[model samples]
Target chain A: MTLDLDFHSTLYLIGLIAVFVFALTGALAAAKRELDILAFVFVGIVTGIGGGTIRDLLLRTDQIFWIADPNYLTVCIVASVMTYFFAHWVIKIDRILLWMDAAGIALFAVLGTSKALSYEVAPLIAILMGVISSTLGSAIRDLMIQVKLVIFEPEIYVTACLLGSLSYVVLSHFGINEVYNILLSSGAAFLLRVLAIELDLRFPS
Target chain B: MTLDLDFHSTLYLIGLIAVFVFALTGALAAAKRELDILAFVFVGIVTGIGGGTIRDLLLRTDQIFWIADPNYLTVCIVASVMTYFFAHWVIKIDRILLWMDAAGIALFAVLGTSKALSYEVAPLIAILMGVISSTLGSAIRDLMIQVKLVIFEPEIYVTACLLGSLSYVVLSHFGINEVYNILLSSGAAFLLRVLAIELDLRFPS
Candidate 1:
């Protein structure tokens, strides 16, 4: 059954989903390290909210989104606790979880770019913000867990996010409806990421 | 010769010095890793401004200090380039550099706590901010370079900063002038750190 939702609400849902997915990944990382409950919670929260926090700081948003709304923090904590207990099950669905994360970050990049554009920043800065928003939280998470950063790897991860953000900026400039801008851009990004995962795409050495 | 300076200017100078010292450490890390110049610059900037950036973000400062004034960024960049070429000389004086970094972070912690207190956050949060300010940049630098985090080490590093910030909060609550509050707290922190290094102080296992 199709659910009816307005544009703003849809965007909000997308952002929330991204945060939740990132938090889960963080918890999973902490679990992989056999860390304590507190570490799980800390990693989850940082992975969930860190990118947006960096974005808001750069843009000088009137209020940091999560700080202004404690719900996001609560969600991260809850996700971490749940993952701490159910890590085995979470790990069992690795492929599906990876796909979900891919979709989540694609949508998140669009949201970040859109937000920056609205703030009247340079288009290049908006694109950079988009990439940063999608990537930084996970990078911080990996760092905390002492894993290699994905960006430092040969993957197409950052390239896909960059293209998605650039697409949003380009489409918006051409007066495309924002809803279309988001869907088309994020859809392309998600597809590229999925292909990369399936084919093990890497930049030529 | 000691040049006379106003209180505000003195604080500004202290902050700038901290940024430069932190940037030097960051560049030295990049040098150790045999990274390219761009990586050196990137890591240096992140390490230099990271702590204060976290502090400003938590407190929602009116403007991000570096973005509002380009001088801080310039200082970090310059310090990184200088260190990249002179890393051997800097390393030769490792003992002196450690002491300088300790003093810099101690002063930085007081600045963070003092700023948070001005915003009227809880005293505990102010103290936490202080520690975050002094410690986070170096933490980020280590993470970037895949070094073991100092906080996770047995050393009394974070403890020193925490005590410094706490001292400032307590003194301010007792109606001490801010200048004296800064001096007493940071001085105590620096002394503690020096003692820790000399005596190989570690948190009891």
Candidate 2:
């Protein structure tokens, strides 16, 4: 089984999209705090690449993704600055923001899981990598601004990513086709997230 | 100059000692919050290895130190649990805790700097890595517990790390002997931190 150049590029596209969405969410959160513009940018960048940074570092990649391609950082900065200036309009679409964030989680879950699998790490660690990739950015953001931890909140967010990564890794082990593996896995994650949002799902009290 | 087996062993010893000290601080912080025992252990582990974990990941080491050697984790757990059961006595020795934390910072500063320089990273990044390695564990602990951010509190903490790492890297570049490099660099950091404690130093308001 050989992955071509196109496969790598598509993964890159997914990663960039996820980073942008996460960056917007970060800037929005910072805006709510009425912090200065620089704070918005800093928080945005952290939210944008924080997970992937940790992921790459954990996997001990030769070059950090953002360091190798500054576009990710640039996107985060641009998105944050734009949101800082136009948060009023962005806030009007809070419903869309929720979905976009879900998409971001799904995308990052796939990316993190695939990266870990590529390193031939244990499946459990791969699943954990996926969760970390999807969640650490926002967790750091909430911590930085002293907001209640979204993960610690009785939400189904981490579960969605875990299922997504689990599905992908399991399918791969079962000899599924590569393209279908990604789609089905990410779709599973995104669907669970959507359900959680629409139904206010959470861990049982 | 080629580093010998003894040099590596010495670093391992320093790292273990530093991890123990940081773990004690983390457990003490959690004890103040009066959280459960598990929270104390969790926070202790985070505070114990958090800085070195980030440093290794950023440096792209082949294996994370803690993952490669679970002794570090064992030390953190032991330190935290002991602190949990012995908080009253520990609080009576608050003055000693502050100095022990300073020692941890200085030791980690040297460890972080030497690792980066071993990788031959640029000086600016080496200094930053040292600061991150020495401070990030405690920062994560503080953020986790939602105390006043020791780093952001207009204090001289980070500056001490920056200077400590700077001295190590600069001395290394100047062809200083390895033993002197380690001692002087860590000493510089520890001295500055001690001054901050005794004098209540802060950056200009």
Candidate 3:
């Protein structure tokens, strides 16, 4: 009756949740463009998996995560379809989308950093990859929908990811427990993002 | 001594030319956005290498072509900087940019398909990748600059790439000489793109 939360399983769980949220965001973005059902699915899949795909490419992984396991693709597609069917309901919940996107960013940042570290990349590059993974998907999605890039907005987005990823790398260097590292890093990012949204906090342009 | 034009070298040459032309197109796209010098270089790098990066990832290549050889990055950056300094003059030459972009698309399509085939991907997938590589970079560039996607225009951009890649694969299957295969395929694509531009041809939406 015990839950198995080993590092690998935990990472997988985080990735699954992140993908779902990212896909939802992608579908929402597509909806704003008044695209068709197929476009919804395409944008969902791209936004959900684009970051990890870029990371894997940079790391020279043998196979992309989605290609290695079809589960991620299924999750993205399902999320997209659901959002498509519920577009009216989903579009009304802008706050929910923002928070969900923040959660997805935090998890993806940590996941990307961990994967890069496992590949023995330099610490700085690993951090860059983490930020890239957390933020690039949404950026691509925004571009596809002809919206302003969130990163270019005055509000903090990539900065939160950078901070979260930096904290993860620093904690890992101190030999922190994986669970604690993930929680602390993701928590910090989520908190910062929430604060930025609520308080209109932004980095100086 | 006879000039060496083996398949590998020929492909490399085609790729080099494609990257350069793609960089120019990227710079031109950036100019339209009034992006600063750094943004020009950034967009140029993205547009010049984005397609091949996608191709390499899909093919599970050991290293991205630009990362393996810094020359591609150099070409993109240098082209961007030059275009930035000459933006006023460059903007006047719309026809030149269109032709250069068309050439880049033709070469990249063949190059992408050739690489995918070498990796033993399914013929259909290889062709798809070819079209993606040829067209996606410009799409990304347009997205970055908030311009309408060229693929969505009446112009026959993606169609030209599709035709080019298809011709290359079909010709290769017929045991044609590599030189003739590349020339005929790329020529077909380039010619089609030129015709599309001159005739204002467009696919029905």
Candidate 4:
């Protein structure tokens, strides 16, 4: 159990780092017509911290992540600065980065579910929180840009996260090894998202 | 007390209607994008429901706003259609509508605070939720469009909601009538917002 907990902790840290990077990507994407530096930082921080903030607030935790560990805030700042400098070069890599986003989704979904379960919430609520943590950053990023959210599209995006959370909950309920459960759930979600993109599979109206 | 409860419930429904209008505004904004009808509906529903959804989730309510009141779903669709058809003319009266938005902020803040207090959350938490319920829809809209959030700016927006929530809590503690408390709190918030806009008063960064 200790090893399981440690593994989840490591995954959570890495997942948070990914959120910072993606938030920077979002800020860069939206920077148009001489973007203000503070605005860029604000967007990056909001996109990065939003999902976890909601998660913590809903869970009634006293320690908000950035407040508890300033490292996350530092990471957001560094990511924003890096994106500000390299935005032109990075913009050319949008397609490849979409896959990174998919990976980030899977990672956050698994990590969120683990955290929610740790708080002794019901499996259903835990799974929902996992999906929210994974999807909300991009949702926020989309709303800020005045675009329709990609998650609300007729695609596998949020559905993949939901399925992944389901997988984790089911495996944990069956006493499966934590590492194996995480791998299976994440892999399943990643593959589904990739397949949806490649095959152009969409939800029916 | 029964009359007061009925009055609060009436305010809540009006707030929901305002949210419906906001959701339709999102749909109308997206109408030129060649989006399918369902896409328009989705955006409208998301815009209308997003704030209260966040509020309910944070309050740990089972499910969310529209989930409990499917009438909100109909309201969103009808409002979206109405906006799409009349937006060309409505855009001409944008200044008047701005005041309507202020009304929305006032009512939502009061309803949000009352609901949070009913849930027995901390006073500070209730105040925060009031702010969230008032500002979250526009925040979601801005985030999705990748626009800078007005809340983080040197604006008095969230400050007004916060002050109103504080007023409600203080008055209620002093055994004020609920209707009078809501009226005082909401009136204060509305006046502050209008004055901030007129006087160009903003937060010092």
Candidate 4 Cα outliers beyond 4 Å, as residue runs: A1-13, A32-34, B1-205
* Per-prediction fnat: 0.12, 0.18, 0.15, 0.12
List DockQ, one per candidate, in order.
Answer: 0.13, 0.14, 0.14, 0.11
lDDT of 3 by residue, B1-205 (tens): 1444466676677677778778888898888878899999999999999888878867788788889999999989988998999978877887987887888899899888988888776676677678878877877887778787665454677788989999999999999987889889999999999999889886542
Residue A144's lDDT within candidate 3 is 79
Off by over 4 Å in 2: A1-11, B1-48, B55-60, B67-139, B148-205
**Colliding pairs, model 2:** none
Per residue, candidate 2 scores C-alpha lDDT tens digits across B1-205 of 2566777787678778789889988999888876666567667888998999889878878888775666887889889998989988878888887888888898788779888888989999889889999999988998888887677876788888888899998899899988888889889889999999999988997
RMSD of 3: 6.7
Better of 1 and 4 by DockQ: 1
| lDDT of predicted model 3 | 0.84
- Worst-scoring 10-residue span by lDDT in model 4 chain A: A25-34
Q: Candidate 4 residues A1-205, lDDT tens each?
A: 7987888687767776677766776678557534677767777777777777777766666688779988778777777777777888777877777677777788778878888888777776677678778877777766666566776677778878877889999999999987899889988888888788778888663
Q: What are the clashing pairs of model 3?
A: B154-B202
Model 1 lDDT, residue B71, Cα: 89
Docking class for model 2 is incorrect
